[model samples]
Target: MLSTSEMTPETIEQEKLYLDLGLSEAEYVRVKQILQRRPNFTETGIFSVMWSEHCSYKTSKPLLKKFPSTAPHVLQGPGEGAGVVDIGDGMAVVFKIESHNHPSAVEPYQGAATGVGGIIRDVFSIGARPVALMNSLRFGNPGTGNVNHLFQEVVRGIAGYGNCVGIPTVGGEVQFDNSYEDNPLVNAMCVGLIRHEDMQKGIASGVGNTVMYAGAPTGRDGIHGATFASGDLTDDSDKDRPSVQVGDPFMEKLLIEACLEAIQSDALVGMQDMGAAGLTSSASEMASKAGTGMIMNLDLVPKREANMSAYELMLSESQERMLLVVEKGREQEIMDIFAKYGLEAAAVGEVTENTSFRLLQHGTTVADIPVDALAEEAPVYHMPSKEAAYVKAFQQMDERIPEVNDHADMLKQLLQQPTIASKEYVYDQYDSMVQTNTVVTPGSDAAVIRIKGTDKALAITTDCNSRYLHLDPETGGKTVVAEAARNIVCSGAQPLGLTDGLNYGNPTNPEVFWQMEKSVEGMSAAAKMLETPVISGNVSLYNQSNGKSIYPTPVVGMVGLASLEDITPSFFQETDDLVYVIGEAKPEFGGSELQKVVSGKYEGKAPGIDLQVEADRQQQLLRGIQAGLIQSAHDLSEGGLAIALAESVFTGKGLGVEVDLAGDATVALFSETQSRFLVTVRPEHKEDFETTVDNAVHIGLVTNNDTLLVRVNGTTKIEEDVSTLHQLWKGAIPCMLNRKA
Candidate 1:
C-alpha cells in the first residue's frame, strides 16, 4: 500500500508538495487552518480534487449566478444530478451537458466514451430513464492528420457507448477551426424522462442510514482526474492518459436497469453517481447536503485492483460506480436488487449524526474532516476581468467583403468547408433510432422524439459557433442561443429550456474572464427574451495548451416541447411549394465561413443580433408551422442561405429549388445573417403564410428538377445538380480522415 509518511506536514512544508497537486500555497495554509492540523496524503488528495474548478466551480459560481435558472415549468434546476422540467401530464424531462475536454485531448477514445457513460449515469441516478444522447464536438483543422484521428476516435467513442446502451444518439452540431488544434472540446448531453413522483435527490438524510457501494468495483484509473481536468493541458498531457476512465457500456446497461429498479423501492434514500472526483465527491456532497456525516470503512469497499491505497480507492473515477444511502433495516432489499444484475452491493459504512466525513481502513482511521469543509466550503474567487481591446477595434472596422469572382465556385467551396459540410460520416455509426422513439433523425434543424401513448413530443438540438465567440464573445453568445431557439422553432416545438457547457480558458487570464462574463450576459439576455430558462450546465475552464487558450466555445443544449401531429420537416415536402425567406439577409460576413475560406482566418465583428427581433421571428415561424401554413422550415446559419437551401435537398429526396434573389450575389448566397430561416409554403396557403409570418419574402418555388438554380438580379449566379453538391459535402470529412498527411 502507498505510505502516508512521505506526506507528513514537515516533508510537505519543506517540499511544497501541494503545488504539484494544483493547490496554491495559500490554499494549503487554509486547509491546515480548517482542519487545525496537517493533513495526511489521503486527506490532501481529497482537498485537492474537491477544491478543483472541475468539481467545485470555485471560479465560475459567481458568473453562473447570472443565468436565470427557474421558471414555472422548471421543477429542479442547476443543483441536482440533472435539471428537471415539467412537460405536463405528470411527466418531466431531465437533462444536462458536461465537458470532457482536457481528457479527450489526452486520450480521445476513452475520454469521449466515458463522457457519454458518465452523463448517462447522471440521468439514471435521478430515477429517469435516459431517452436520447447528443454531442457538440470541436476539433482543429481536419487537414492535419492528428486532428483527423482525434475526430474519428471521438465520434467512434460516442457511437460505441450510446449504441451499446441502447439509447438513441440524436441531433447535434460540429464545428472545425484551428483554435481547437491542441485542445478539442467534447461535450456530451443526455435527455431523460420520468414521472414526477419518482424524482430523487443526492442527499443522505436520516442518521444511521446504511451507506452502500454498488455497480463496478473500484480501480486505480482516473485518479486525480478532477484536478487534471481543472488545469491547462501541456506538452506532457499525454502522460495523464492513465487518468482517463475506461468505460464498459454493458456494465452501465446492467447498472442502469438495476438502479432504476432499486429506486422504485422505498429503501433507497439517496443515490449519486461517482463522477469527477468519484467517491470522495459523491459521499461528502451527499452528506453535506443533508447536514449529516458519513463514516465509511474503506476495507469493506469493493475493489477490482488489489492492495489499492485508501487514497486511490477514494479518488479513482472508475466508470459505472454509484454510492447509495439506504434505510438501515431495508439494506438487504437494495442489495438483492443489485445482486440480481450480477453486481456488487455491499454495506461499506453508515450515516452519522456528527457533521464529519471519516474514512477507516484495517481497523484504523485513515482520514477525518468536516463534511462541509470538503464539499461546501471550496474557495470562491471573483477573478479580474478585462475586455480585449481588439473587440471594439474589430467591430469598428469597415466591412471587408471578399469579392467573389465566380459566385457558383464560392458556393461550392463553402459547401466543402468542414464546418458546413455533412456529418453523416459521424452520425452514421450511431444508432439514432434505438428504442423506436425517434420521430426525426439527424440531418435536420433539430431531432424530434415522440412520447409513447401521448400526443406530446420533444425537439432536441446542440449548437455553438466558437469562431464568432473568438472574435466577439458577447454577440456570438447571443447568436448561438438565438440559433438554438431558431432550430427548436423550426422543428415545430415551443422552446422549453436549455443546458450549457461553457468551455473556456484559464480564469486567471483577465481577458478570458471577461469573455466568460460577457458571453454569459449575452446568453442570459437571449434566454430571457426567448423564454428559455437555463436549467442546468457545467463550466470547463483552463482549456489551454502551452499557455495558448482555445476559443471561448460555450455550447448550448436545448430541448423543446411539441405535439406529435405538428412536427415539421426541414426538407421540401412537395414539388412547386412556394419558397420564402422569413428574415432579412444582411452583408454580415464577420466570422463567417466565407471569411474563413477567403482569408484562412476570421477577424472583424461577430454578427449582431437583436434578441427581440429573433424572439418575434421564432414565435412567428412556430405559429405558422403549427397552424398548418408552412410545409418545410430551416434556420439559416453558418454558411447561411446557400447552405440552408442546399441542405434541404441533400437527403437524396430528388427535390430541388429555383430561386431569384435581388441582392449582391455573394451576400445573398453566403452571408451568415442571424434570425433568418428558409421556409416553403404550399401555393394554396401562400397568402395566409405571408400574413402570419412577418417579414416573409417570396423567393422562388420548390421544384422536382433535382437541380439548384439561382439568379441574382436577372443574372445566373449558381447552378448545380443537387446530387453533385451532396457528394462533395458528404465526402469532405471522410476523405480528409482517410487521406495521408
Candidate 2:
C-alpha cells in the first residue's frame, strides 16, 4: 500500500483526508505555510495530533491563565508533568488530574485501566513515587442496564490497574445524572512524594544527549487517539475502538521501580510520559523546553507489530511507555537499569543543536519540522462566547420549595438518591490501604495520608456539583472550589493547592464557551480568596454525545497539610456531645438533591457565596479543630443538612442526634446553602468552641439513643431510627444495580 507521503497536496484535498483527521481547511493552510511546502503523510499526522484540542489546549489556554497558580510553597505550577509543592522537611508532593472521557465511552474497561496507568506514569516520570490515587466519576441513572454496566466496568478497570500497581486508590466521588447518559466523565488523579534534591524535569537539554525509549513496545493500536479524544461522540463512535489503549499494570509496576532507580543516576537528564499524543508530544516538548532539537531513527523503536509505519510509531498512545533523555556515553548505564526490571530500553534518537525535529525510517527521511512549531506554535482561538439563555431564565424563576408532608419519609427517599447515596459499593472494589500510609479512608471529607518519618500529613479530596454549573456557571465555579477547600479544612488541615479537571461540552458553541469563561473566572476568584493556588490541571472539551451536552462539570482535586495530632474525625465521638451548625443555612434549594427528586430536572439560580466570608469561616473552624474542640466535622452538601447529619451518624458507631432547627422545617433540613458545616463539640469544651467559632450555632446534642429526632416550631417534624436511615443510604446504589432489566 502507498504511504501518505505518496499522495500530492491536490490528491489530499480531493480525498479530503485532513478533514477526517480532525483538521480544518484553515489549519491545513497554516501547516503548509509553516513548512513552506506540502507536508508528507507522517508529517501531516504529527501536526494533526499535536494541534488537536486534547494536546494543544488551543481554546482553553487563555482562560486557564486567569487561575491563581503561585504561592510560597508552590515548587512547580502548571505547564509540567505534575504540579509540585513543598510539604516541609525537604519533601514535596506532586499531583495532577486528567480525563479519559471519549475512550472510556467506547471501551470502559481498557479505557479506564489505561487512564490510571497513564496518570501514574506522569508522576514517576518526574522522579516521584506515587503514594495515593483519587478519581471523580460522572454517569447516568444507575437503574439503567447500560449505565450500570459502564459504571461497573469503569470501577473494575480502576481497581484492576491500581491494585496491581501497588498504589492505594484512597478516595474520590461519584455522581449520577441523566445529562451524562451517553457521555460519561472519568477523571483520574495521582499524588506522589518526592525529595526536592531528587526532582527531575521533562527537558531534553545538552546538544549531544541520547534520546531513549523505555517500558512497553510500540504498536498500531491507539494511532489516532489524540484526535479521537478531541472530537464529540456520535452514534458511530464505536467504530473508533482502535483508539482505546490496552494497559499492563505489571509492566507499569516494573517501569515505576526502574524509573525511580534510574533517576538517582546523574546520567539521566530528562524524562516524560508517552501520554495523549505519545512519542510525538513527548519528544517535541522535551526538545522545545531545552531550546534544542532531536533526530530519531524510527526503526530503532521497539515495535510489537510488524512493519509499522512511521506515523503509527510517532502517534501511538501505547500505555506504560516513557521517553528519556540521557547524557551521551551513559546510555549503557541507563539501559542496564531497565534490564534489571525486564523492560525493553533502547536508544532511539539523539538531541541536536539543529533546532528541528527530524525522523527517519528504513534509511529514508520521513518527517522533518521545527520542534517549536509542533510543541508551542499550535493555533489558539478565542472562540466566540455568549451567556446561555437558560441562565437568565433560571435566575428569573422564583425558588420552589417542595412540600414535605411526611418529613421522615422524605429523609429516607432523599438519602437513596444515587447522587447523595453512599459510594461504598464502588470504593469496596478498590485497595485503599495497600501501602498502609492512609490515615483516613474513603468515608471522610478528605483522605489523609501520613508521611512515614514526619509528623505532617496530607488531606486530599475531589469535588464538583455539575447541576449547579448548569444553572449558573460563574456561581457554580466559585462554589466548587470553595467546597473543595472546605472539605480540607473540615479534616483539620491547611489548604495547600489544587489540580483541576475542567470537563465541558463543545467550545465551538458560543453558549458553551461562555460557560467555560465564566466558570474559570469564578474558580480563579475563589482560589485567590482561599489561597489555594491552581497548581496543575487538564481540560477535556467536546464532551457531547449526538447534539446534546453534559453539564459543565469542573472537578477540583485539592491537597492540604496537617499534623497527625491535628486530624479530626468525620463522625461523632462521644455520647451527649454538643452538636453545632457552622454558617447560616438559607432557603437555597436550586440545583439541590430535593429539587432533583421533586422536579426530575434542574432549574432556578445556583446558591451564591461570599468569598471573604467562606475564607474567614474556614480559618475559624480550623482553629477550633486544632484546639481539640471539635469531636467531628462534616461539610453540608448534596442532600443538605439532613443528609450530612445522617452521614455523620451512620458512618460512626451507633449514635444519634436530637436537633431543634429554626425556620421552616423543609428549608432548614433540605436547603443546600453553600459554606455550611455540621460539627460536634465535647460537652466540657462547648463554651470554648462557641467562643472560638463565633458563627457556630448550638443546635442539638449527640445521644446514645439510636434515633435521629428533629423538632421545629415546637412540633416534632421528623423522627427516624438510625439503623433504617443507614440501610437506605448505604443500600441505594447496590439495590438499584441488583434490579433486573
Off by over 4 Å in 2: 1-10
Compose the digit string of candidate 2's lDDT tens values, residues 25-117. Answer: 999899889989887778888999999999999999999999999999999999889999999889999999999999999999888999999
**Which parts of model 1 are misplaced by more than 4 Å?**
1-5
Cα-based lDDT at residue 3, candidate 2 = 61
| Candidate 2 vs. true structure, TM-score | 0.99
- Worst lDDT run of 10 residues, candidate 2, spans 1-10
TM-score of each: 0.99, 0.99
Local distance difference test, each candidate? 0.92, 0.92
Give me the overall lDDT of model 2.
0.92
For candidate 2, give the lDDT of residue 669: 90
Q: Pick the candidate with the highest lDDT.
A: 2
Backbone atom clashes (below 3 Å) for every candidate = 0, 0
lDDT of 1 by residue, 1-741 (tens): 225656776677677877888789889999999989987788888999999999999999999999989899999998878999999999999999999998899889999999999999999989999999999999998977899889989998999999999999997988888778999999999999999999999999999999999999999999999999999899989889889999999999999999999989999999999999999999999999999999999999999999998889999999999999999899899999999999999999999999999999989899899999987888999999998887878878788777789987887898889988988999999999989999999989899999999999999999998888988998898988989989999999998999999999999999999999999998998888999999999999999888888999999999999998889999888999999998887888899999988987788978789998998899989999899998989999988898888998885779989999997888888888889999999999988988898999999998898999999999988899999998998898888787778
